[model samples]
Every structure is written in C-alpha cells, then in structure tokens.
Target chain A: MNGSTSSQKHPLDGLLRTDRIPHIWCPGCGIGTVFSSSLIAIRSTGAEPMKTAVVSGIGCTGRGAGYVNLDSYHTTHGRAIPFATGMKLANPELSVVVFSGDGDLFAIGGNHFIHAARRNMDLTVICVNNLNYGMTGGQAAATTPYLAKTSTTPLGNPEAPFNLPLLAYACGATYIARWTMLHTRDLTQSITEALTRTGFSFIEVLAPCPTGYGRKNKLKASDLLKVYQEKAIVKNGANPAETILDLEQGITLGKFVEYDRPTFAQNYKAVTSD
Target chain B: MEPAVLTGEHFLNGDVACAEGALAAGCRFFAGYPITPATEIAEHMSKRLPQVGGVFIQMEDEISAMAAILGASCAGAKSMTATSGPGFSLMMENIGLGITMETPCVLVNVQRAGPSTGLPTLGAQGDMMQARWGSHGHYEIIALAPASPQEIFYQTITAFNLSETYRLPVLIMADEIVGHLSERVIIPDSSKIKLRSRPRPKGRKDRFLPYRPGANGVAPMAHAGEGYMVHFTGLTHDEKGYPVMTAEAQAEMVDRITGKIRKNLDRIIQVERYRLEDAEVALISYGISTRSSLAAVDEAREQGIKAGLLRLLTVWPFPEDMVRELAKRVKGLITVELNLGQIHLEVQRCAEGRAPVVLVGHAGGSVITPEEIVEKIKEQVG
Candidate 1:
C-alpha cells in the first residue's frame, strides 16, 4: 500500500510514512505520538514544507528528519545542531527544525545546542527526551530520570535527569516549552508554537521509550503515557517534568518557562550594522 | 604593456592577502582557531569579516571552528577557516562532513613542519600528503597551491568556485614561506572571474534530497528553511541521504563523491609549465619556493643548463600527467621546495622512475636558496 495514503483527509495524511509503521517504538513510546504531533505542528505552521529543513542527530528522535519529506538532514550523532544552524544561516528564509534525542542533544551535542540557543538562532529544536539511549539498547542519558533502570543503569540511575527546559531557558532560547506524548495535542501545539516562533525555540518533548526504558521499568509505553495523561500538569499549573515521574517521582514538565528575547539573527544583524 | 610596477604598491603578505581574497570573494562566515604561520589569515578574517556584512567566530578550539564553518556553509554563505598543520588535523572530521554533505566551504592550511606541532613558526610543505589523506574516508579534494599573493588572491576565488561547483570543501595549501612573503596583488572585479553556486532542486522542494547527485556528481543544495531534505552524515548514505551502511552502498556512495573529483581531474588540476620545450632539465615546485626555483631555472639557463620550471597550482589531484609528460621531454627533473622534501616525491612517482630525480630541499623556517636549486640543476644536468 502507498505510504502517503493514510493522511488522505488530514493535511498531514500525505506527509507521513505509515507503512514504515508497526513502528519500532513501543506503545506509549511517546516518540510515535509526538511524531504524529510534529506532523500536525508542521502542517499547522503553514510554512511551505518544501522550504523547511529538518536536521537530526543520531537517536530515536533524530529519526524525525528522515521521516519528514522536506530537506531532511540526518547528520552524525550530536552534530545536528551545527548542521541545522548552517542550513538556517545558509538560507535565512527557510525554517530549520532540529529533532534530536536526549543523549544526542544534552550530552554529546550539548555545547552546540546551548550556543545555538544562546545565539537565539532562527530555528526550532524539538528534543525528544526518552530519558535513556534507546537506539543503542538503552544506555543512561543526561535526561534519564534519577533511579531509572536501563542496560547500563541496571542498579537504577544515580544521576538526576537534566532539566532540559531549564537548560534551554538559561541558554537564552526565546521560546521554551515542555510537554509529554500523553498530552499529544498539547505537545503538538507547543511544537507548533516553537516552529512558528521567530527566534530560537526549544521544546522538550518527554517521550517514552516503550521497548527499552519502559520494558525495563515494567511499565508499558501506554501505561507510562496514561501515567502522563493522569500526572502531567499544565505549564501554568505545574511543572512538566514532575508529571513524567515514575511510580515514585521528582521533576515536572508542563510549560515550565518562556520569555521574549531577540534571536541570534536579530543580534547578528545588529552586530553587522554596528 | 606598461613596464611592470615592480614593487611600489603597498605589499601585503600572501597569508594576509588570502584573508583579503576571502573577503573579496564575499565570504561572510569564518571560523578558525589561531595556529602558526597560518594565524595571519584568521587574524585578518577576524578583523575584516566584521567590516563587511560577515561574521568571524574564534571558536573555543579548532574542532569547533571546523564544525562552525560547516554550519555556516549550510547557512548559504561562502564560509571558510584557516589553519596550519595540527589545527588542520583537528578539522578533518568536519572536513569529511563538508565532503560527504557537499557543503561548499574553504579550508586554508599554511603548511608548517608536521607530524605534530613540529615548527610553529617554521615552514614545511609536509602537509602535502595529509591534505589528500587527512580525513579517514576515500575522497578527492581540490587543493590549490599558490606561489604569490596575487595567485593566492585569484586562487582563493577559484577555491570558492571549486568548492561551490563541486559542492565540497577546497583546501588552500599556502606554505609558511609564501604565506609570509610580501607580494603585490590586484583584486579583480567580481565579473571578470568565474563563480559557481550549487544547483537547487527543481519542481517540488519535497523532492530535494541532500545527498542525491544531479547531472553532475553534486546535487544542488537547499539551505535549512529552504524546505528540502539535507541529510549529511559520516556514515554511508544513499542519494536520498538515509543511512545505508552496506558495503555495496558504501562503495557506490564513496565512488560517486570521490569520482566526481577524480573524473573531473582535467577540469580541476592546474599547472604552469615554463620553458619545458627543448629543455634538458626541469625544476618542479610550488608556493613561494616556486619563485626561488624559477630564479634557479633562469640562472641555470643563463649558465646554459637548458633548465625549465613547472609550478603546480593544483596540488591534490597532483597533475601527474603533466609531470609525466615533462619528465619524458627532459633528461633530468629537479624538485625544489622549502620543505625537507615533499612534492618532489610526488613528482618522482608521477615520473614513473622515468628519469633521474634530484631533490633540492630546505626546512624549519629557512627559505630554500636559488643557488641551492641551481646547484641541483647543475648536478642533474651534468
């Protein structure tokens, strides 16, 4: 069957590759739901998909660039930020979006992602936080919540998961928002907001890795997503990370923090003028 | 024409001129960390790019500098970086990235003594080999070796074009001697010289795949936000840019990228053959050392040595054919340069052991003398 056939009625129906589905992601693996939400976000941006560039570094979420039909750049692990920055700067008119994995973005690619945000570059970064490295069979990640069990962290995670939104907020991203796949609609809206925003926009999507992290935790992807559905508080109401905590819990993830800040493009323009 | 102005114009060193050349070429993005002899290019770019509507970022380190320029290139500006020896070594990963991704960019390497940080301020063409095989993967690069500030100015433009047209990074090997030597260069009008830009996808932008080759090996690139698929990875990838780690796919993928350069060698390889016809001896050289070799050839000819000169403008493709033909015509070939001896070996191999090869070499910041090269010619001719 043709892959583009699924979105027959929805604007994004033709945009997705459904046949590739029966996906590698487990149910409640927020990646697929978030992936669907991203399609929705991109569809809503009204930016010509043809003119958008999707660049990803290695990871489950890094695959986002591959699924998109537009100029999709799947670069080396942890280097997508620079590539995306280059693509955006090469053609300031194009909307550059980065779909990166937590390990890829916060660990290996941490420096570039932070600087790009600081530059308030005119691009959007959608960080899919599964809390562990699922692509590599579940290694501990910077975003892996504390006490989480994984292949490497079989004894439970010792380090606290990075507050990605707080990091981005501190790095000076103009738009910073937090959401989880359980709140797919809200996550999609946040992604849409990040996509449409004029400056550097970073959205932390607390996705679940149903197979690796979820299986290890004995929680199905759906169970964790339902946990998200039940536990997640609104940005205006509660923390986004706190909503994603385990059977025991810590941080929260609603729209944690956001503010107005001139982007790198504007600052660079000012630097050039001066 | 009017008598050549000989040296009245304000003289700028070749390395400095490379910076000016990049500025003249409309390069807006420069990312580099300071490194010996080549530091002048970065210093100049840092001071000058800001004067234009350009940006110069002194990366925390060379690796980041290399990564940043690759980033800037996708931003759709003519991007460049400069280094010598070790710093150039740091840039290899991203240099490989620029190649596989077909990002148009320039990397200037002012060769200094090598292997490690051998001679910080000293001169050596030791990087001739690394410039070709520095990155781990199989690929072909357009590396230009200029002898004068004037050539550096012109060649920088060519470097940009070669990079843009081929959608790959071009290396400028400006050895320390030439990079520091003062020379006069006339910045030409933009229209007078050739320029090339990567071809953009036609019809639907959704059809744009970053790694797909167009009529030429290089597919037109759409910058980020241009709404195209641009997958650039060090891994083996298909034209559509999805990762293909299979050996067959790797072979095909590498072949296409390297082949674009290898097959187009005739268009990329450039050499200047001076007085090779009926000459009994020929001296081959590049960079500032070419000047001293030219003088040596003239002296040897005045002494009736029947010596000629062949200066290489393009180094990486090696100009093997031209060197072979010159070897056949001349009884003996003398390769002279500032290094202990680098390009000479390349000339010898290209000669295919056809003739007696004399290597006139020098090292570690000292200029090779014309007298020394003439002595080599005398010994070879005799």
Candidate 2:
C-alpha cells in the first residue's frame, strides 16, 4: 500500500462512489471527462445531494449513474428519460437528471425522447454522443455521421445522422446546447445551466470512443480532440436548423435554445389542484 | 380531501373496480398506455387519481408506462399500470427491470386474446404462461386471477399488498370478460381495509445497504431522496446495490429474490374451494374459467357425480402442494381454462401421474362455458 495514497483524495470524492472506481471505461475514452464535468456541475450547483437523482439507460456512459453518489437508477435500455420524468413528477422537490449515450437516447429509446421533450417535462438530459455504440463494440448508431466507418458499417454509414439540436428544439426542449468533451469548461457550464433550468433541458456532448469508434475511423484519441479544437465553431444562439456537424464543413458548438414555458409538473398541478 | 375508499355499494365493471382498488390501496402514481379491455382502468384512474392527490400519466407506449411506474415507486410512491395483450408484451422488458431492482409496483394485464392482435375486444386467459415467463431471465413473480368484478376489486388491493411485502412487481391477470362485465362491488371503509407497505431501512443511514435482506429475506427499501443516496440497477447486484458480474453474485441475487416468496408460499398463495370437502372429482380453474367451474361443479353434483371446484385466486407461486394432495384424493383432475393447456401443464406436473389430468381448453376469443366444463368433468369421471 502506498502511504501517499491514503493522505491524498480526489476532489470529487464526496460526490462519487470511490470504492467502485477503476471504472469500466477504457483508456482514452472521453466518457470519463464528460462524467467528471457533470459531477462538477452538479456539485457547483449546490443542489441538495439527497434530493437529486441520476437516471441512465444502458450504454458505456450510462455507467455514470452508478458512479454518482446520489439517489441514482441505472434503468433498462432507452428508458432513462421516462424514468427521470416519473421521478420528477412523482416528487416535484426531487431534481432528476438523465445521463446516457447517443444510441440509448436516439435508437431504441428515440420515441421516449421525443415525447418527454414534447411534454416539456422538468428534466436535465445530458446525451454523450460518441457517434457509435461503444458498449457493443462500435456498431452504427442513430447519430453516426454519414459515410463514417463503424464495426457495422465497414464500408461507410448509409444513413444520415440526426441533428440533435434541431430535434430538441422542434420537440419543445426549453434549453438546448452542444459541446465536446474537450471543451470541459463550456460543457460544464452548459450542464449547470440545464440542471438549474425548468422544463426539458438537453445537452449533446461529442466524445471520443477510442476503442469502439476511433480505430474504425482511423482517428486516435488525441486526433479526435484536435478535430474538435480545430473544427468546432462557437456560435451561440445559432438557429438549430443551421447548426451543422459535417467534419468537412465544421462542428457548431454553444447554447442554441434557451427559454422557459410551464413544465409538465406545473401544468399538472394547475389542472389537478382545485 | 377525497376519501381513499368509497365505502358503499356501486355497480362497476372489473376494469373500473380495479382502478378504485388501486386508489384505495394507496397507489398514488399510475402510468399507462391505452389498450383494449384494460383501457377503462386507465380512464378511471385519470379521473380519480387527481381527486385523491395521486398522479396519473398516459405514457407514449407500454414500455415507457412500465418504466415510469418503476421510477415513481422508487420515489416513495405506490405506483401501478394497466394494459392488455400487445401492451403487456411491450411492458415485459421493464417488468424484468422492476423485478431485479426489487421495486414494488402493480401491473394489471386485463388479458385479451392474441399472439398478435388475435381479438382485441374479446376475452381470453391465454396469457397465463406469458405472465409467468414473459420477461427474459429467471425470476419468480406473483400473479392473481379474479373471477368476478367484486373479486378483482379485493384482489387488486391484495396484489398491491403482496407487491409491497415481497418488494417485487405483482400482476393482476384479469381477462377481458371479467374486465368488461358489470357487477356489484362492495368497497369497505378505510378502517376495514388492510394495507401493507414495504419495510423501510432502519439503523444507521451511513452504513445502509439498500439490498441487504432482513430476517424475512426481503431487503428494506429506502426510497429516493431519503438521504441514503442508494443506487439501484437492473443488473445482478450486491447487497450495496452495485452491479457484481460473477456467477456467485448472480446465484446469490436470484436465490434471495425467488426464496422470499418460496419460503412463504402459504401466505402468498390463495385458493377458494367450493364443495371440495367430499368430492371424488376436482375441477381446477382460475379467472373467468373459475366462474364456469363453479357452475359445472354444482351441475355435476346434481347428476350424482361427486365434483368439486378449486379456484386459484393467486395463480403464480402456483399451489403445487395443494395440487399434489388433491391429486391423491381425487379420481381425476379436470383443468379448465381459455388457453390451450397452459396452467394445465402445471397441474399435470404437480399431480405427478397420481391421477389422470384432463384439460378443457379453448382456442381464445371466448370464455369456456359451464356446459363445456361439465362435459369434460363427466368424461373425466367416466
């Protein structure tokens, strides 16, 4: 045992299940950075730890719920949003957050996402878009870019990816933003805003899946960060429809939609409470 | 405030009575997607839940409806959902999640006929086996079959009670005939109703193990936002509710969950016997078929045939010991159901060839009548 290890503790120790460490994430995976940023955002918000809950669907990023030292639930595939909705509606005092992956939020669970956003449910949905299914070994995902190479799409992806910002905006999400894991400060701030906001708040984070996605696309972990640093354009308040993600063109990053409307809980109370 | 139990006689269909039963049982959260036969339950809940300070939501689909109830139940609310065949099929995925996580919630499958949209408006008990093995993986579940609207009202409350005690999902497997039939239901006063709640964690909050079983082999539940900060997952987990990926851990988890009900079989399994005292022939049935079996038993007795009816109110942790005992005493056992020999197989297995087992089965879209069951009983007695 190292004597130094006993004296020094990580900063997020109070907010993490430190015993469950040596986490399942592979080396060079960007999910860790995004997860840490989320923890920091949750901590910084000063929300009551006891009253806050984290819900995640099945995926590599979904493991974030298990690590968080909160009243957390790791639910079935594509169901984090609905679970969060139920928790929030059942107890309005509790703050519910959904932390999951692109495929989980868009593929098997896509209908739930659309309906939750449409209801303007009070939830913070942080979707880590690795562009492919990381846990299942880099299969083509709903958000995989056209012509991108994955285990399921060796030649190239035939389907076009979903424009997450536009979908969130169209579905009535009150707050929407896009960022990369490399943009830790910006991503953290975006998450903090979503956590504090009412109604449906969505944040899409681009992350590097080195083992599952990078090798297939001939990009290293660092090369993926470089792509974000070089190609990402910071354009806050851009029309969601105008936000593009084509690598040859450029990646649009920043808050795209921010406003408020009566949330599902509020409307429920208004109608039900005589 | 609205009274939890409406203490008076009322004419109600089985579907509507089920909703009232849930409200009276302290079920405050209901999430369901519309499906035939069971749709009235949702409709009634939507109108009544709000009046009683409960929340009701019609989700996007059956899958989300099931997921939502699990989430609500975790947040310290008694939650439930109602659906039919197709919707029940969709709900199986999350129902498995509810079981593994040990979340207490009630699922009502007002079963209609179907492999796929076989007969949406018609009644059938074909989903009996599906209710037992619908969800993937190995786990024990509690399911109740109510023969009448009045029985459904009482059994729905019983379903919630069992779910709370066992810390698992309890199913009310009512058929379309029972769901749609109108009858008199007498809901007793709140003081007369027996309600059970899941055991809450005690002792030290700092050392709380959310999945640690007590003397009863069931872990005390600490709801979300109770300052315990418990973690729950659908994966096979340890006592601390952390995923433990090992065969040993898997065995331990499965054993504790299945064992809780297995050990307390007498308390969980409920059967109503009619004239079974001095009968030489036994007719075993449940749900709508139970009603027919009762009439058939009376008809057989008038014809000088010593016939008895054993109606299973609790169909799942099936009454194996009782069946075995009855098989030894009876000349033959006649199993009547709307399905093509689903629960009959269980009765046959439990009988162990001590007596002949005869199945009076149907193909769906209708209930097996008393005449049909009496005919089978006569043939079996001969």
Candidate 3:
C-alpha cells in the first residue's frame, strides 16, 4: 500500500501473520521499526524460526508475539519473563525471547526482570522503552524520565527513571546493550547477538510513542529520531553505570557488557549431579 | 536401582506422599515456593525430582511457580507445583492463563485457612470453593479432595491423569491436616500405575490448529520446540489459536472449554458411597471432613439411625445427578466441612428441597469433630 503493489511481497512476510496486519500501532510509532528490525535479525541469524518462541506481557509491544509466526505466547501483564524462563528451562534447545514494554517489563514485572537476570537464565529480553504506558493512555512508567509529564503525571513525574542497562548489569546479565529506533541496524545486530549468546541477555530499545509520550512532550516522531541521531553518543563497551539517559545532555548507545557465566540450566545440572 | 514407584507400605505424610505420587505418575518438573504445610511437598520434590532425571525449582514466588509449570507442560513434560492458601492466591492469575491456554499441569493447594494469610500452619477446607472459582472468569476445573495421606498419593496420580485428559490444570485440594498428617501409604508398582499423556496433534504440523477440539471436545497439544509454531494466549482465541475478540468468538471459546468438562461430567466426577442404600440420613463431606463424617456415620448407625456417608473424592463437577438421586432416597443430609459451609451450598442446591440439608461447619484453625458431626446427623434425622 505504501508505494509497493499488492503482488510485491515484504521480505518478512513468511515470518509474520500477514492476515493480522494493519497492526494496531499508531502512525510513526517506533514499535514497528523495532519489531521489523527484530524479524530481520532473527532471519539473518539463521535461528530456526519454528524453534524460537517469543513471549510478551501486556501492552503494545506485547502484541508483537501475536503477529509473529513462531511458537509465541502472549501472557498476562508483567509476566512474560517468568513464562519465557519456564519455556527455556523446560526445553533447553528452544531459543526464548521476551519482548515487552517498559511498563509491562519494569513496573509490575520489574521483580521478575531482575530475578531472571540474577539467575542468569538463558533468555534474550528485549525491553521496548517507550518511556510511558502507551497502551494505557500514556501513564507514567518505571522508565519515565524525571520531570516528564504523562497522563498520570500531569504535574511532572517525581520519580527518577530506572537505568535499565545498569540494573541488568547489577543483576548479572551476561550480555547487555541499549539502542534507539534510530539505530535500527545496531539494534537488530544486538538482538541477533543476544539470541545466540548464552545466559540472560538484555537489550533496551529507546522507542518513540508518537501518540503517547511524543504528543505529551510536544515532540513529533521525526523530532524524537533527530534527538537520538544528534544526541546519542555511540559508546561501545561503555560502563553500564555511566550509561544513564540524560536527554538534555546526550544519550549513550551500543553494546555495554558481554561475558560468560554458568547459566541457570548449567548450574542446576552441576548442583544436581552426584 | 531405585524403582520408579516406591512400591511398599511406608509411613509418610501427605506432602511427602504427594511428591512420591507425582514421581510415580511421571511428573518430571516441579516449580514451587515454600509455604507451611505445602513446603514439605516442595522439599521432597527438590530431593526426588533430580534423582529421577526430572527438574525441581524453588521459584521466586508462587506466581512464577505457576508460570513455570505451565511452561514445562507446554514443552511436553508432565509438571506440577505445590502451595498453600496464600501461595495459591498468588497463583490464581497465572492459573487462569494455564486454563485459557489449555495447558495440562497439576497444582496442589495444601489448604491453609485464609482470606489473606489467615492461618498459615493450620488446616482448613476453606479453599474448596476457591479451587472452583479462584481465578476470574467462567471456566470449568477438576479438583480432587483426599481424606488421608494414602488417598492423597492415589489422588495425585488421578489429578495428573485428569489434567492430561482434559488439557487443563487439575487441582489437588488437601487441607493442612491431610498435608501434614502421617499415615501408611501403599504405593503400587510402576507397572500397575495408570498414567495419561496429552493427545498429540494429528495432521501436518503447519496446518494443525492448536485449539481445534476433537470429537471428545479436547484439542491435542503440541510442545514449544516441536515446530508446531503454535501461538498461545490468555485472550479469547479461535481454533487457530489467534486472538478473536467478539461476542461470538467468546461464546464459542468459553463453551468449548467449560462444555468439555460439563458434557463429560459422568466420567470426570468420582464419589465414594458408604451404606447409602435405604438410608434415612446421609452425611455428605469431602477432604478431611469426610474422615470425620465417616466416624459420625458409624456413631449414628450404632444409635439405630439409618446413616450413610457420601465422600466426594472429586469435589467439582458437583456430582449433581448423584446428589439429586440421594436426595430422593434420603430424608435428610448433613454436609460437614472445615469452612463456613462452602460446599454445603452446592449440596443444598442439588438437594432441591426434596430433603432437608444441614451444614456442620467450622470457621478455620481446626477440624470439625466426629461428635459435632454426629450431633448434626441426629438433629437432621429427628
């Protein structure tokens, strides 16, 4: 429809449920960009599409699992990580990825996120940080920057946002990265790397919610992308503690941490053996 | 080599026997959090599961425990989790997910008294109704009540079989007394044990509709990595397992899930009758209360009153037809339970005023005594 004829197929057509298209994301929402990049990465990585399962919690990002042509699960709010953990441990051969929003993954599900990382479960968790609960009408989320105005924070958010990478690093994530929708190539590559990497790998995608956070902040989708393009410093291997997001100064992007550790399954086997 | 079935009479508690029962039934994955009375089950499972080449995880909490077992079940493993009232309350949300996803797993709720952590160490039959309607929304569930440690061992296996048969979560509702009480449990040989596995999907993997029910109204299940590419959700889904939000879709989906058990109620429901033939008074009970009612029936019979006991091994599916038939033959019925008349309400409705129904109930923290139950039987008979 967008300059492509009906007969001209999309590359990710086989990887998606095409009939469920005209997806619910609003125009200029960065979730589509991030989702498309993920599909491309999954394809590029040569991961068995059927053997890969995507699990998601409630929110717009959570809907990604539904449209994906994989063994996906759309679980309850704040529960994708635990559900994916189960799927991974139950069958170690399957590649499990948890894709959900900041609110769904860090608010109600924050405990699960930290614990899963702590346990170093073999999972790839992709948190699409839109900075607010977009599906619930742009309410303040755990990733909402301090002083940001949301529907629930009309007076300005009093709480400081979580430094997601730092949290993952503190909780013993074996691999960690942060990228923006503007960094689609890097983000996609990071996802591909995370999928192949063992143990808990976390990727935080700073996405724009044009209708939610953007509308409230007086920044359009283009303006949001411009901010990431102009202000984002590509700092590969930067210390996670130094990667705190400060939109007024600059944002840092790139892979931060990658190391080997005995995963939950490995440790479980080791401890259980005589 | 240790036998799969620990085939010998051993004095064991309900929680330990339950763990052994799960082992014998081929449950290979158990994820649970420790709570009083139910903690023993997890402890035993942690020691036993790995020895059998199975897995046991003490999850972060009850919520994750429930999710983990559901995940294990989806991956083609018979899985189980054990918890008490407070932990069971935490599990209600994901238990709904298990039901909606049609995942076959077993959950053992060793009952403790509670609205919110009411009594942690004490036993109560308060969760009987919760087991039926704990999770939100309308859906049918199978719950078996065991009166003793021996019964619990057998009932645990039965729970697994029913869960596999229906492709839904089956509950073993054991009270704190039964969970902690020790008694002789005779576990038969592994060859003698009946095990049920979920029916595998037929046809090509690509065309298989994960939610499409067969003639028996239960869809075959496919594991996660088996390349079925199945999509599961808690939302209202169609036969293809895609979310379909409409009144018609909701009706069809709800009916299929609830109707599967409702239509096959005769096969799912199990009741134990004792001397009910030509009885003037019937003592209806389940779980630990059935033990007391059994004693009460003996006392009432000694007093020359025609008394009988109806023990509900399967507390759900209500056993409505059987209750209705018993109501026509018996002049009066006394329902005994540790709760404040939870199942008594179901018995009353089924009696339909053909016979006077009375409730001998306790609030919590203790069991209803045999003397108290006998008194209720006398009052009902008089």
Residue B292, candidate 2: C-alpha displacement in angstroms: 0.9
How well does candidate 1 score on lDDT at residue A189?
Answer: 81
Order of models, best lDDT first? 2, 3, 1
Q: Please report, as a residue range, the 10-residue window in candidate 2 chain A with the lowest summed lDDT.
A: A1-10
What is the per-residue lDDT of model 2 for residues B1-382, given as tens digits with 9 covering 90 to 100? 5887899999999999999999999999999999898999999999999998989999999999999999999998999999999999999999899999999999999988888998999999989999999999998999999988999999999999999999999999999999999999999989999999999998898899999999989999998898998999999999999999999999999999999989989899999899999989999999999888998999999999999989999999899999999999999999999989999999999999999999998878987888988898888878
C-alpha lDDT (0 to 100) for residue A120 of candidate 1 = 78
Which runs in model 3 stand beyond 4 Å of their true positions?
A1-7
Please tell me which predicted candidate would have the highest TM-score against the true structure: 2
Candidates 1 and 3 compared by TM-score, better number: 3
Among these predictions, the greatest lDDT belongs to 2
Report the C-alpha lDDT of model 2 over A17-111, residue by residue, as the tens digit.
98899899989999999999999999989988898899999999999999999999999999998888788878889989999999999999999
Query: How close to the true structure is residue B220 of candidate 3, measured as C-alpha lDDT?
Result: 94
Better of 2 and 3 by TM-score: 2
The global C-alpha lDDT for each of the candidates, from Candidate 1 onward, is 0.77, 0.93, 0.91
Sort candidate 3 into its docking category.
medium
Candidates 1 and 3, the one with greater DockQ: 3
Give TM per candidate.
0.86, 0.99, 0.98
- For B1-382, candidate 1 gives per-residue lDDT tens digits of 1111122344789898888777767688887788878888988876676676677766556766777787778767899989988888878877888888788899999888767878888787778878888888788888999888888987888898888889899999988877888977776555555667767777786565566677767777766545454555656778766667699999988899988888888889888888878789988888777888888888988998888888888888888888898878888988877666678788889898888887888665677889988888878867
Q: Is the docking of candidate 2 incorrect, acceptable, medium or high quality?
A: high
